[model samples]
Target: MSKRKLRVGLIGGGGIAQAVHIPGWNNLPEAEIVGVADLSEATARKAAAIAGTKEVFTDFHELLKLDLDVVDVCTPNKAHTPAVLAALESGRHVICEKPLAVTTAEVRAMGELADAKELKLMTAQHQRFTQSGVAARAWVDAGKVGEVYHARVRAMRRAWLPPSPGFIDGKLSGGGPCMDIGVHALDLCMWLMDFPTPVRVSGTAKTVFAKGHDMPNLWGEWDRERYSVEDFASGFVHFDNGATMVLEAAWMCHQPDNEELMAQLFGKQGGLAWPEATFSTATNGIFAQGTLTPTTQVPHPHWNEIAAFADCVLNDKLSPVPWTETIKVIGILEAIYASSNTGAEVAVKG
Candidate 1:
């Protein structure tokens, strides 16, 4: 740990702020929560209490002027680009939660500004830090999987609604399942396949659940009338490496066995899986489907992802999860929606 702890300014004090950000930041020895902000002063104060800080403000702009080292943004999808850009322009580093931005243009700018300022910028795709995900990626990198050819990523929830008003609005969320949850599976797929350049995409985002049919989710019932995006999405994305991925995602579907999250990597020689890090690889002349094969010399858990972000900020290291990677995912998601709307395959544009 460094002698000087990084002071953090937080924007957004909702459940994600309380449950995810607070606990995640507390685990780091190099970071400190200095100021908290939200749309409501009450919410900000509540988060301050949980974080053991008395500095609470309803305005993030005021908080940003407090000479903070890094700004942690857990706000809605729409606010990501603005908050991050302001933070970077102010000469503060930033760690934003997933879906980097609602659009590729913003993500590019975020990346560009960070580079120009020599500041650390990271997106919180914490699932990348999962023991199974990390282990699986290592296996692929070590050539244990042997010539990867297919990636199947599934993030299907029975009826899980984001529960936030902004989440269902296309203006705020960009899209539905892909931006909300599918990115996790996609990230795992990309990581496992070594981030190959996607050449073409054919996909659809169905409005099966967006109709707001009567359904119950762990997050509770969402008003269908207010629903503005797709409920299910499927894509066939071809990469420059000659490998193709089958991406499937949904917020609510009639599928029998629900998989809220997971990516299955299939290589020419063997297969690997996640949500529980395990693998099946070919050795000598035999192929195994499910076996206890140690992926690498070490294994890491969820907190490890947050630690990576903190490490990057304190050490001034560029994030392994680059904005270019995030922008590509955004481009894919946008293309998927475009393909669905026009009933034609869409090319991913930078």
Candidate 2:
């Protein structure tokens, strides 16, 4: 007798779902995507076809009717909360895309529901599944970078502003570069630091170049009138452990690199940088600097992330990227926007 395959349902059958997530679910022999839901019927049909399933729905609620073991949410930032809450309520484990809910309140709502239901809820932060990221994390776990005190994170793009309404519209996407790209680097940084409690944040968010025609977008033009979110944001964070961090994110900036995504951690014993996987330390009055090599290669981080989520559900293990850690990430980001609005330091809870 063969083991029954884990049936999965997909919410938001858009680019991320079709491009990486659908293929990711397909790659796992123990799991299969049974249905796909999208706002557009055509998109839902397209994603369903790719998943080799006939189940397609224009409404996610209809997809939720299926006897699915898991729900993968690839929706835009704003839609995450409702979809995740619904999936949790339906007694299904869930994996949602980054910036999980844009705010801590929404994160708590979904998180608490999942906890009550005893279902796994994971955030799809694929950067942490990369080869370099794995190597850096192992090193940090081994106390290579002991007692981290300060960190620097950046997610800057020269001129790659996504022209999509879901990205530019604050009502849909919640925030701009801070929430879109900044969340990636910030999450990785905090994860490496063992998720220190964020106490306060002071930041600035502005729409510097998206509305203007001076800086041409590399990904093409976006609607100037609908561009309500900030193109650039920066923040200073203070943690409960007396640690501090400086973060910067931008969609358009005058930089040498087309895009520079980085997270560097400074500690008392050593300093480490991610993606680059470089580390520096001094012992016995001698300087040592070297790159950490991963024992295994992760060419497809998205697939690994999908596999990790599925494995947790199948084996009854803890979620790889739990909501507790995610709330801290969102809390800092929410504080950044709050501080930006009031021009004052915002206190972060939890």
Task: Highest TM-score: give the candidate number.
Answer: 2
- Candidates in order have lDDT scores of 0.80, 0.95
Give the alpha carbon lDDT tens digit for every residue of 1-350 in model 2: 99999899999999899999999999999999999999999999999999999999999999999999999999889999989999999999999999899989999999999999999999999999999889999999899899999999999999999999989999999999999999999999999999999999999999999989999888998899999999999999999999999999999999989999999999998999988999999999999999997868898999999999999999999999999999999999999999999999999955
Worst 10-residue stretch by lDDT in candidate 1?
A: 294-303
TM-score of 2: 0.99
Best by lDDT: 2
Clashes of each: 0, 0
Off by over 4 Å in 1: 292-302
For residues 231-319, could you state the per-residue lDDT of candidate 1 as single tens digits?
Answer: 78998888888988888888888767655598878877677777666677667787665644545432434356667778887776778
Steric clash pairs (candidate 1): none
Candidate 2: clashing pairs of residues: none
What residue runs in model 2 are displaced by over 4 Å at the alpha carbon?
A: none
TM, every model:
0.93, 0.99
